[model samples]
Target: MSQLDTAWPAGRDVPDVEKLIRQTREQEQQPVCAYIYDLVALRERAHRCVNSLPDECKLFYAVKANPDPQLIASLLPIVKGFEAASIGEIRTIRGVSGDVPIIFGGPGKKDAEIEEALERDVMLIHAESLHEVQRIGWIAERRQQRVSILLRINLRRTLPEASITMSGRPTQFGIDEIQVPEAIRLVQSLPFVQLEGFHMHSLSNNLDARLHAQMVATYLQCVQGWMQEYALSIRYLNAGGGFGISYTEPERRFEWNDFMEELHQVWEDYHIPGIQLIFEPGRYIVAHCGYYATEVIDLKTNHDQHYAIVRGGTHHFRLPVSWQHNQPFEVIAVDDWPYPFPRTEWRQTTITIAGELCTPKDVLAHEVDVEQLRIGDILLFHIAGAYGWTISHHDFLSHPHPHFYYINGT
Candidate 1:
């Protein structure tokens, strides 16, 4: 089978998993929820993604996905730059990107953040609001620098949404469609502000390649009309990335090769000079590179429903609760169950996996079928490379943070 078609967690660095499992057996860490990443696999996957795009498309790693130092160091050399949403993310990428470009974008940004953007000399600051543009201009004027700006427009259009939507309609993420004219005026009025392009990121975890390509084509056309109507020159078109990875339906995942193939047609349909395409993918780039593991603490059946309580709760890995999907998992059985009491084992039975949190929303997977699960069994959640740790509320109830391990190997 083709590399792209291969089932994930199959070709990944399994030796690392084995090593971690052995560590758990040795009691190196108790009830640990560890994220294991294969840097080599990530390098290969990212290289393919970067190479598949046309010359106009430049890939930027969104640091909010996973700002782990090792993750940034691995992707820093592969991607064009990092796209950050807050001051902390900007600082995180700055330490590793070196001369590579960085873009700062987020709504309701503080004046202090604007100052930091100027001091850091970001490639472009996406103006999500009219006031944000004025703030950027204010900062640039004081610094005596012409700051490049990308006007983020929340269009009136909609696409097939995944789990979340970052743009389109009246979202706090970007300026509304009707407000663009006033926004343009605000940018043009500033002496130190340079309006170079537009940023339209409408959806998150979008899986349809043809629809995604169509959205980009439509976005470019829409931007072109606005530029001509406003008499502005568009130098860059940031097709902010919402490319998706399948959490439940792995077979229905986005086809990178097919999507890029369609993108080739989309690019040719509206190829323009001096208009560099920017793709800031947060989930798709790193979602498949990391794994989250938790050990089973207890097994019980309450009111005819079987359940397995895990060591960590939504405080450590919250994607299942956020997405509201029974996350897929694999059971790594342990031969040794050190408990003195009689152990509960299930076969040909459905079980709900829940976390140790007191809240009812601490469920990880519901009604999952397993083969012979004991108290010491490990549950490894796949497709947790992005938004797994960082998105979680680790401080809830002041629980101990899970151990994080970055593994690169043969």
Candidate 2:
């Protein structure tokens, strides 16, 4: 059992799910697959996440994680703002978010996107490269306005225990740290762009609290030195969110208190008047508020290996496949086995769970332990609120899309 006292993630007995299934079956709707998000839980989760942070910090929801209008609307009141990766995300946030600050980020931003950001007056544009800074200055100069910019710095030192490293290596994310001085010089030459601060979003999915704290400390040290070197006034230090949620061992999770305490030290050590610390957390904020449900279609033993096939495949839920890790799920035992034939019994056995697809790469959970599985049991995957449906291939094999439902938490 995972210790989730404040946040209720599992959809084992959520009312909306029962009602959704009943209504869908009543109207002869296929219970192929559907993603249910508990807005109340999401709101409460957001509160818990932001409230735990220090006053010197600001929490911004990463709209690229869910981007559901309802979810965004629920979080608007709780979060300080949103971090968007594309123009579509900005538009999506614009519909539900009123007057909330939005930060536009992404490596390959279009010229039209710069126009839209200027038109919308986004909080700032994170310049990933020198060319982007020049383009933004070009656009702002034509508009007779000065656009605030944050030079995204790819750090030279790498942090340990991160699942994915974006800024740690020389890849397409931000300006290399060695080239920061040149970028700063270019910004100074541009008349329409004002350098607000630095953005160092290095790691992704980092679980260790100590290492996470060390990464923040490193960012603070790097930014402080750069500000002193260039004689620049830094406004915002955007430490891009990379908090990790344990999918396998839930008992051993990220230590929030320890991490926050470490942040308190960093704030004291790197104290600069009026410089705000911003965190854009996506997965940690909303991952627990969603549940992906699919009905069991077939149960068989293929070549002495038990396999459980569901109505939905990796097409609808691809997080497990994307991470190359088996997603953890709980069995929602529905006793309504309608078939007449006696299903094969697999007591105390492990099975491979997959979806109904022609190819061999449609696995959702591999080698999962199951006490018993019948014809019509529902499999509910936890920690799915973040990148569950938004990142999936929805139209493979022309299968009907799954029904989406937003439910309550309590």
Candidate 3:
């Protein structure tokens, strides 16, 4: 098959994922299909995120997104802490760094998870419901240890436009706004549960930076009002991260520089001396650092539509199918055709890339126009670091797992 040109971001001196894919193909004896990560890019992104934030703002990586040990370790020095959604995540963070802070947050926390979080001495446990608060208080009282927590509030305000809305509606995530007073009263009565602040994480996969700044403003205002009305001395405002990475349009990204400037203005206008702002972002911090490279196993045309079937499918990387969007990809033409038969190829045609699964829904990219592709070509899906492997149904077809490699930063 003929070689195809790959597009790189203009004027950005970043180590490209294409180079890594090529290197993997050359080294692997078998057909190369793996999830490769660039530690250099991950570290650079983490450093940029930390440096751009206001002095009062702290960046925390939510471990639910790409909990690979190496990825977590690479980000340890730059990020202030980690936001773990489960006990397993807490353990994962601890396995990487024993001293690094961890905040446990998620709905439907079992008693065992709470006990483990307390044992680990996590920085904060985001209490989602009144029952959870009481459970924590009970556990802490039984253990005779005072524990600090932030109440996850599902605010009544309408959320900004986002791919997923976790709050501002009836959801299993956090406590409703109307019940905050009752929760606070319950917390006050509990001897061991100390209310540190509020955790208002409302959105997921949000792309608009301006809207994010406005959301931050609203959170700060709501917290300020609560502080005044209840005579409460809050210490932290955990605005859970919803920063997005564009899978459809790579150029259309979250404007971090502009958002940071606006965040600084918000801090200056609503400056609270002791209250610290926490942002636990999972997808944005590591999404661009990962790439999933799958070699084309077969090429064909069905009813005038071109199709490229890869060795891996939604079982290995499910983001595109999960979000129902065309995942951005680039074709790397491999000229080595060992077969005696002539290699068939498609030129300047739209192709639907699917996996070797029984169901027809195992599509990665649906009808994406490509310059050229062939049976031996490799399609590298970018921005796949977070929510790719962990969220996939790996054992659905009992297919062999994909290889994983990390490119250590030079």
- Arrange candidates by TM-score, descending: 3, 1, 2
* lDDT measured at residue 178 in model 1 versus the true structure, 0 to 100: 87
Candidate 3's displacement at residue 56, Å, is 1.5
Task: Provide C-alpha RMSD values for all models, in order.
Answer: 2.2, 2.8, 4.7
Per-model TM-score on C-alpha atoms: 0.94, 0.94, 0.95
Q: Which residue pairs collide, candidate 1?
A: none
Candidate 2 achieves a global lDDT of 0.83
Per TM-score, the best of the predicted structures is: 3
Output the number of the lDDT-best candidate. 3
**Deviating ranges (above 4 Å) for candidate 3:** 1-16
lDDT of each: 0.83, 0.83, 0.87
Which parts of model 2 have CA positions greater than 4 angstroms off? 1-28
298-351: candidate 2 lDDT, tens digit per residue:
888889988898999888988899988899887766665556888655668899
* Cα distance off (Å), candidate 1, residue 172: 1.7
Which is the better candidate, 1 or 3, if ranked by TM-score? 3
1 or 2, greater by TM-score: 1
